[model samples]
Target: MPDYSFLNLSPAEFEVLTRDLLQKELGLHLESFTSGRDGGIDLRHSRSRKREVIVQCKRYTGFASLKANLEQEVEKVKKLKPERYIICTSVGLTPGQKNQLLTLFNPFILAPGDIFGRDDLNNLLSKFPEVERSHFKLWLSSTEILQRILHSKIYNQSAFEEEKIKETVRLFVSNDSFGDGLKLIERHRYLLISGSPGIGKTTLARVISYHYLANGYEDFIFLSGSIDEAYSLYNADRKQLFLFDDFLGKTFLHLKLGRNEDERIIRFIERIAKSDNKLLILTTREYILAQARLSYEVFEKPAIRLANCILDLEGYTKQVRSKILYNHIFFSNLDQAYIENLLEKSSYQRIIAHKNYSPRIIETVLENISTIRPEEFVSKFIGYLDYQDSIWKHVYESQITPFSQLILANLLTAGTPIAMNDLELLIRAFAERFASKYGIVYSQIAFNKAITELENTFIRSSRDSKDKLVIDYANPSIQDFLVTYLNDLQDMMGDVIDTACFFNQLVSFFAYEGPGTPSQRPRRTHLAVTPYLATKLVNRLTQNFVELPSSTLKKRLNSNTEPYYYQVRRSVYNKLNFLRHSNLYTNNIAMRNFTLEFFKLIMIPNHVQSEDIGHYVSLVIYFHNEIPFEEEKILAALAPNIETLSDYHDFKQLEALYTETYAKFISKSAAYKEAVRQMVDWEAENVDTLDIRDFVDDIHAIVDHTKIDLANVIIDLEEKFQERDRDYDPDEIYDHDEDVRSEYRAEEENISDMFDSLK
Candidate 1:
């Protein structure tokens, strides 16, 4: 029942923290966010001049809940200028949400999900060769019997706010970068630092109190007692901002707040509000809880006048962790090839091991580094964090395909309605592999302490239980899997393939599992576009449409990104290489003009009405992106046999065709012009929004000059038909108001005869 820590790192403190994260944790460099104008872009960690990175820290309590808001805010900052954005929250993303979130934000990151698909368990084997797959799962799931243990403390904001920050001030002091103390206050304001238990709180608070007392602001006073005593201290010649270390009520009567001496505090703030020159600084765990209750009376004024600007200080992220661990800007003795290889091998097991890479925790891990190898150190770390037993471990190790009734194949894979046998088999394999690869292993009774974990992580009741193990990945284990595995896998494989494959496969098999592929459908799988999938799908589709080569894929994926994810059309052919070669574009070897092609990755799988809303938007956008030109022009130029917009048949024929065309071919039509304009406008607005790549299951006709011309072919045909009817049936009544007169046959005949005689 105490505040977590006051051992919060000040901005000056982050200098050392950044160096620690970069050098020890990541093979990166620490570029401070000295420019406060940069939203939350705290630092850049790059291995080489060519490789750039942007580190964003969201030091929030419920960090996951805040991703959407921060993502939007930071993205705006990214677009204000060209800069990489690797936005990280000190409060780590929920496990399962990781992949979904990453896929959703792929364009904004340096890499797509291609490199980090959690499914790529092969990478894990390579990274942690010593980890026996079977024992790992058990140990990870059951801490009592397992050799090691992990405990994901699902932070209750309410409980956190109750304790307040008056307790652990020293730990915060330990990491405080400012040595002399008083000058340290110059860097971070509104400094809100948070972390796990035992990290540091009261210690840092004491240190901060000492700091302000030693500084010029000696008039300030600290108060943490009953309401009357607290209010009396409020009578001092306080600075413009009064620092309230414990805003939560210390007495039962003061709990609800806004009364008694707290009233006096409110009146004081009212006077300050009138001046527009007052500030109120306060701290409390009560501020961390759900509906974080900060009574207006806690401050010498109304709540808004004091704590309106909320900064949820979280534990440390990798950047800060690295700084605390290593004493340098970037990795000193750390090996880049090693980490990348490990990432490629373990596919991000290290990230999982370094789960709570908070400054406090990372410091703990590093302090004991000599006790363990990097892999062992990480394994031990994750085992104890309660973020282990990831569902990714389930998917990667088990044969998800066998569960016919509840079968879990790549949702994009070809499959039929599952039978019970299939579902059972699927779960069985899931269990087996889940235990073998990721289960915790040890010779002790660690499992007994982890009954909760089994219910939370394993899903099954026991080791041999066969009940369905489907879980809402939001649980720490499931979420951890998503973050650690799925996201990692997605980054491992190309986005076009990963996003489209998994989401589409799921869309196809589970809901509409009965339907077969459309006649002549492309070999590729369908993709899903929750708002999370929007921007990423766009990037993949953009590359495919622009005809980026496979070889250049890695280079593009590794580019440092800011919060700004790519819009389908903006970065479609826009990304340029150092030599100005674009991954999505190629030199026209034959025609000698630049061209964009292979834009299929962006296609949505199903046109189902009930599919992902983002996908539907993507389908519509794809239509909007098309240019109107006749099929003949396209044929003559790139001469794609692919379907054009003329009729349903031509459109249908384009299903499997991978074709290319010059801009000239599609630039001729007014309709094409409109579609392109609308698409650009839409991309401008929604690029970073969700659902740029919609893989429709129904049918997707490539948008081209001919296609734009064809979308309205029926209108043209009907017009021609009306013209023919009017010319042939002159006697027929039409919508026109004009009258028709009949001719006299006898008069015309006589005139002809007379003319002949005269001749």
Candidate 2:
């Protein structure tokens, strides 16, 4: 039996619940009307043209209030003179009160059961358990279930407030994804939810997690740092669930998994699959997951393919989308005027049909309605739908403090999940350099206060696997908003570079023109570096090369005690790479000459590593006809390290150099042939443990050049795969793609028909 308070529902929702309950109890379809002055007809049923049954629903918290409201409704009920009248109220009714109500609407209300009270509704729900479960808010908001949910350790791990969860449940509209996700998790004990940004992956994950928690699951763990945390907390004796949100990463730069992280995650999935008491849920952007499969071999396994549950726009049908919009509008703080504008002329239908519709953008636009006038809400809302990217612009510009903005900019410049200590150091450095420009006083107290202010909004803090605190964007869209915001402000870009404490920040945040530059660099994607800004960056680099503070360089170093050797090496490589391709560095005589002097001072002493020698070679080769470095000088500096290069990437670089004007010189060298042979031998020896997909291209290139035989390695790889296939069971394979497509089509058709009736 449910001791449902029914306080979680709005007046409209309570009416719908009552209609649903009575329709089941009476075994007849009840027609409901739009919310307004109902004239004593909340729901209606007709057996013939002359016979009509009318229901009036009142959601009241006190019996006195219900009785008083009923007195007013008696006259309205008499005007139509229905064949029967029914009353439903959330307020409990005593026998005396029911008898008095029966006397007031005498003939219409013929029996006590004709007037349903709070206890009567509960009893009906007990009779129809399915109806109770269907009304999720009714059962979930019950005091007993809420206590069980909130007091659980899992709720504490996520830091979700009780009221916040209630609000989330109120606005959430269940779709095919929820049912599909539960079935997937039940079968495999693990689920991977992937979709584009703002497509409700995180929300779906939370809803499913809460569902399991409401059931018998005793513990819920949020894996914020590493898969190892899941393993550390696994208990085979008790039911447990784990969630690793954004498991691959949120941004492209952070997509590369940590050392063997892919392998650890796969192993953990296998472990969870073997246990009946455990479940794991992971979410990532769909594109990020594709990139991960390309970068990490373990993600390409068949098990991971089976666990994927993709949430796409097709999964959100017209009716579900309408319900989502209605819930948000009903629960929002907007006044009736604004709501009316949104609902006028079926304006909401345009929003649902818009190409750029997303749940996050809708929420963001509604949450910031105070920024727009009531008359302008529909136009501005459609404008937000059209642009979509500017949804965060108003809140970011006007809502946050300037110090907090600087902290977010620094976080964006530094990349995310930065060590808390490292972020504080960068913040202190930024404040010391630029606080006066913004009219802010620099203090440790202010820095801490800024971080605190930004938490759970623009940024979030969590401990890594080592229990060290780190900070990252609360949502990936924040990173997107900041990138666009910063790209438009050249002066701010300069400020970030000028106050950068690490050399990597310059490399990470900006790029010089070159064939070697990454396609995803800021210049191509977000920031357009003006010549003035480029010149500023070059000047900063040169000054840092000459007079970089020891403490600053020490803070930048990561577990290396080479005292500034690596920093100097990185500076030389970046400068030479820039000079080779950048028009400003090559055509501007002063900048070119200044960079050449720094390069000579750094490179003439043989400071380059074997891995970085390719950059040096590219510089000299690209400028062999333009610059005047002796060929012998370049070869003498690089020849001693040719035998030490063991990886295929190193050999690939050397091969590129060999095919250039240096082909005859490098082809005739004995050390170059030995390096190629050693790389081939290493691959052959590790074929059993390596992914052939990773090295197949390298092997083909090596074989084309050296004519080395790798047939035995290929045979060994084929034999291993064949043996595994022989051991696999065909019956265990689940074709999720076909089944999901069929289910989606059916759900869309069903919902389309159902929504037509409401309209």
- Give Cα-based local distance difference scores for all models: 0.32, 0.67
**For every candidate structure, what is the RMSD over all alpha carbons to the true structure, in angstroms?**
34.7, 8.4
TM-score of each: 0.23, 0.69
Q: Which candidate gets the maximum lDDT versus the true structure?
A: 2
Q: Which 10 consecutive residues of model 1 have the lowest summed lDDT?
A: 550-559
Model 2, 1-759: lDDT tens digits are: 776767667556788889889999999888887555677778899887458898998877898888898898889988878899899988888999899999999889979889998899999999998778776667766677777777666621546668877777777776777778777787677888888778788888887787777778888778754575665566557888899888776333432444356777887887677666778898887767777777677877886554354445346777677667666766675687887677567677888787777788888888777788988888888888887667777767777788888888777766766767778887888888888897676678988898888888788887533455667678877876776778888898889878877544554445444333343433312454566776776777667754432111111112321111111234465445634454445434556777666565544427456656656665555544555554444554565454332433443454454455345545566665665566555655654222444455566766676565666655665666567457545554342344422121111222222222232
Tens digits of per-residue lDDT, candidate 1, 1-759, equal 111111233323323333333333345556664423444455666556545566654434454555665656645644533234454433434456556555555555554322222222223334433332221221122222111111111111111211232222212323222221222122222333222332333334444443333223323333332223223333223443345544442221111331144554444444333322223344444323222233332543344334343333344333333333332212123444323333344433354236444333333444344544655544554543443333235333542322211212321121221222322333343434433443423212333232233332223221102222222111212322322343334332232233232211221211111123222111121222232333343344334533432110000111221011111221321221111221111221211121213223323232222112222223323433453333343223222222221222333333233234334445454544454434333333432111122211111334443344333433433454555445443342222222321111110112112112111
The C-alpha stretches of model 2 lying farther than 4 A from their native spots are: 10-16, 27-40, 60-76, 94-100, 151-158, 293-303, 306-308, 461-470, 509-759
